[model samples]
Target chain A: MDIFDGIATGFATAATAQNLLYVFIGVLIGTVIGVLPGLGPSATIALLLPLTYTLEPATAVIMLAGIYYGSMYGGTITSVLLRLPGEAASVVTSIDGYEMARQGRAGAALGISAVGSFIGGMVAVVGLMLLAPTLADIAVGVGPPEFVALAVLGLLLVTYLGTRHPFKSLAMAGIGLLLATVGQDPITGATRFTFGQLSLIDGFDFVAIAMGLFGVGEILHAIEQDQAVKALTSKVRNIWPTRQDFRDSAAPIARGSVLGFLIGVLPGGGGVVSSLASYGAEKKLSRNGRHEFGKGAIEGVAGPETANNASSTSAFVPLLTLGLPSNVVLALIFGALTIQGITPGPTLIDDHPDIFWGVIASMVIGNVILLILNVPLVGVFVQLLRVRPGILGAFALLITMAGVYSINNDLNDMWVVLGFGVLGWLMKKTGFEPGPLVLAFVLGPILEGSFRQSMLLSDGSLGIFVQRPVAGVVFGLIAVFLVWSTVMALRGRLTSGAEMIEHAAADEAELEALRSPAAPEQDRADADGGGDARATTRTTTRSRHEEED
Target chain B: MSQHAYRFGALAILALGAAAALGAVQLGLGGLSAPGSGLWPFITALVIIFCGLVLIVEDTPDDYETWTRRSGKVGIAFVALGVFIPVLQLLGIILAAFLLLTFWIRFLSREPWRLTLVLAVAGSVGLYLVFGQFLEVPFPVGIIGRQTGLEFGL
Candidate 1:
């Protein structure tokens, strides 16, 4: 059947009462978690993964997919109203979003964001429908050598795109790969790292590692900081933007949608990079001379918000088609699918058309649900921010421990969770990104299997990797990224060392601003239980200086 | 001496790599054509060692801090988790969860006693009913539950 026929079949399947309910619940939970600081989509998905065990694969994926994109919508609320980024992708949004709020145009900022997000998400879903099947069909011809190259390239790109410190990321990836070898060897049946324990025979549980790293680790970090967030007391007056606002944002939204979709297709270039790139592009392309780029510019809010949502939707392409997750969130989704006995790869589309198409259909439906939920119930979501971190952290810990144990009914898994939780906390303290490590861990066995298969096929010749055209190209890209990053790092150290220090100082100042009250009104608000108002003022002042610089 | 911490971390990684390499050698690294189980791990260990060497060279002095400042909270948290495992096996998920939550809320976060007690009891019992009774997950009844003749049928 054609793609349209498949999607239609998917819509029919997803239109069921049970499936629709799951979609609503997923998006609802997604928005809630997105609005709450310290609980990102990755952590939320990891925390809820075990519950999906009894669910049908399609329904489970549909719900998880909702959470992924629903967060994009939820993140904007805090950025606009509170000058706080709910997630990394929303960091850029706070620049202009909070400015708009300061100018009492918060409604316009949120309205444009919601509309832009809906459009971007819809476009990305269409792109996913068109691109994923074609990519899968093309990938069907891939040999083991190509698979190895692809996995390696994916690991490299994700590391490079996600962090400033590639070496540390690589080290984490290496550790993850090493950890993957803990179970019995796939080919030889020889145990490598189990140390003779029977439970070690099956290897470390994926759910336990994920829950520990993202969930428990995040909780520990949050507890140490103990920062209480204040909700916006000012009512969001206008939920709809004026014609002038729409007119200004039209091009930016369109450009952001396409840019975000393309970027999202790349490994490690999902939510964060897409929004940053979109913001840069919008800044460069804006023709309105009177409008300052970062000072409450509609394009600023529209572009990044749209792009992040679009990127999140399109990130599913690689995972669904090539069995490769482009980022950490997708890695968690991949884990969810694996636990459901569904291997996500090229064959996934052909084998489980219901799951593939049903998930895509659900994304489109999810966008509509998010828009409906967000535009009306935004105040309600803001109120949710009042729930104290202490209470939330306590319950979250209990749930994580219980949820992880349910995976295999093994107490040993709890040990794994606690161990990784400590490691994850240390990694956080030291500025090491756990994202690359988790992704590499998930992809490590596949990479190793493919590499060995290629070796065996070529009679153990290393030349087989470069001999294949696809593998050769992938390897070339990997080499280019490595060389380019090294050159960039060297150049940065030589030329921008002073500038980097200044940037760090400014970042410290910005953080300090967030912790204190900036203005008399804000001081009053803080005195009245508003927590910190200096964060908002500093954001505006800092952005102005950034514009000047 | 903050720079020494990075060097120390690098040294730790290098030591780990050396140990892994030693283990890999014992596992038997065959030739490339017909690889042994140890070949892949051995190569990974070498890569880790290279990374450690590079990290030592690139080490900056300001990265490390005294562990005592924040380590107290992390140490306590770790101790709580460590205590939890044996407690879970001995006392059951319900009692274990209650104790864990109470400790975290009461001691770690310093919430009020009434709030801590309410949350600890409600959270643990609610989770038990949801996960054990409704989801039908097989949870250990432990000495307390068994002694009380209270069994949750999975």
Candidate 2:
């Protein structure tokens, strides 16, 4: 059927009482998690993935999608009030948002951000409605060789765009591919790495690994750090923006929507890049130069906020049409879908029309819910930041352990969670990006199966990858990226050799300071302790500073 | 993470790769046209070994840091989780969860003993009711629950 009719069906399905309730709960949970420092969307979604097993596939997807975008809105509350960015995507927002709050225009800043987010999200959903079907239609004709190229390129882009240390990321990806080789092989049905364990014959459970890596691992890290969070005591009033504020933000919202949507479609380009780009664009595009850009310009808040929401919405494009998740959050969603026995690809639109359209339609409803939740319920969400991490961490651990075992009633799965949890914690401690590893783990089998199929089809000809026109272009792009990254890495090492040493030394000093017995109390006495804590966390974790580099 | 740790990690990874490669060889690497299951694993193992070698060569002294008392806390937490597996199999999920929460809350985080007991009981029992009774997850009752006839209705 046509796009409009499919969306209409989706709307009809999503409007059901149960689906709407799930949407509300999803966004509500999303906002709470986003408001709390150190709990990101990936961890929250991975933690909650097993709970969706009992629900219908479409409902599960709709709820998970809500959590993803709902976070975009929820992240703004902390950035504005406390200047403590709740997630990486909101780091840019904290600069101008906190400035606005300091000038007692916090209400106006939040109001404008909410409106901009709604507009950007709506526009991107409209783009999704128009573009997904066409892309999926074209993708239906893609062959095994082309798929091999696409998957490889996707893996490369995920590493290159998502991380600073491409070699490390590449290594993680290799490990992920090797991990996927466990259990029975799909092509030959031979057990490769189960180690005579009957439970692992089917392979490592994705939900278990995800819960371990993101949920349990994150909780352990947070407990180890025990970050000191200071609550903001600002009173929010007059959430409605003035006419002047609306006029200032109108052009920025429109520009950010378009720019963010386009950027979101690119691999490794999502909320973080789009928001930073939007801020830069607005700073450059400011006419007459009346408003100071850094010192609380409404455009600074409006542009990036709009762009992040728009980018988050449009990130669904690749996953829905090409079956490739360009970012970590999308990668988790990809896993969620796979667990439901639904493989996302070009034929997803035809094979699971309800799921494809329902999720798109849910985004529209989710944005509205987020806008409302951000405005009136901002106070409640801010209170969520006050809940002690110890309490939250305990419950989170319990839920993760229990939820993983419930997936297949296998106790072995719980062991996997614990094992990966330790691995994940170490990865975090040592400055490795788990995003590429997780993404590669999800995409590895697809890449392997397609590569083998293409080789067989071409009778062992390695040239088969470049023989097809589409595949050839993709491989060409991969080659270009590989060369570019290698040159960049080498040049970076040469030119910034001293700077690298200094950065490493600075990191060492910071760790020493953290280890000092009296440091925590002294830090709590500092006026900007929350911001400093957030900054230290960001610097220590490479994933959090992706926007800066 | 220190330079020594990096070297150790790299060596461990190299050992793993070597083992995997040996296993893959036994599985038989068929020709490219009709590839065996070992081909992909063997190739990936080589990549992993290459990464490990690079890491060993690239190790820098700047990466080293002295271990602190806080790291001991992290180790304690890890040990608590490790101990939880047998506890879960022996005492049932409800009681095991209670003990785990109590230890993490009271000892690791050093919260008030009163609040620890309250939350540990509430959190464990609440989770048991939700997952066991409400969601119908088959949580094992273990020997204690079985002998005492204290069924959780699973």
The number of the candidate with the highest DockQ is 2
Residues B35-66, candidate 2: write the lDDT tens digits. 89898889888977887776677644332223
Give the per-residue lDDT of model 1 (tens digit) for A1-549.
689988997898788998999999999988887777557777778788888897899998999889888888887898788766666577667777878888988889999999999999999999999999899999898889998888888787766555545566677778778888888999999988888898789887888788877778767665554444464645687979999999999989999999999988887668777887788788777655446765778888899899989999998998999898878888888999999888899998889999899999999899999999988888888887776666677787778888887878888778888888888777755645566778888998888888888888999899998889989988988888778768877776421211221222224543333232322111111100001111222233334434433
Q: Which predicted model would earn the best lDDT?
A: 1
Model 1 regions more than 4 Å off: A231-234, A287-290, A493-549, B1-3, B61-70, B85-95, B142-154
Interface RMSD of 2: 3.2
Query: CA lDDT, every prediction?
Result: 0.76, 0.75
List iRMS for all predictions. 3.8, 3.2
Q: Candidate 1, residue A369: CA error in Å?
A: 1.2
- In model 2, the clashing pairs are none
Native interface contacts kept by each candidate, as a fraction: 0.55, 0.55
Alpha-carbon RMSD, candidate 2:
5.8
Candidate 2's C-alpha lDDT?
A: 0.75
Q: Give, for candidate 1 chain B, the lowest lDDT window spanning 10 residues.
A: B61-70
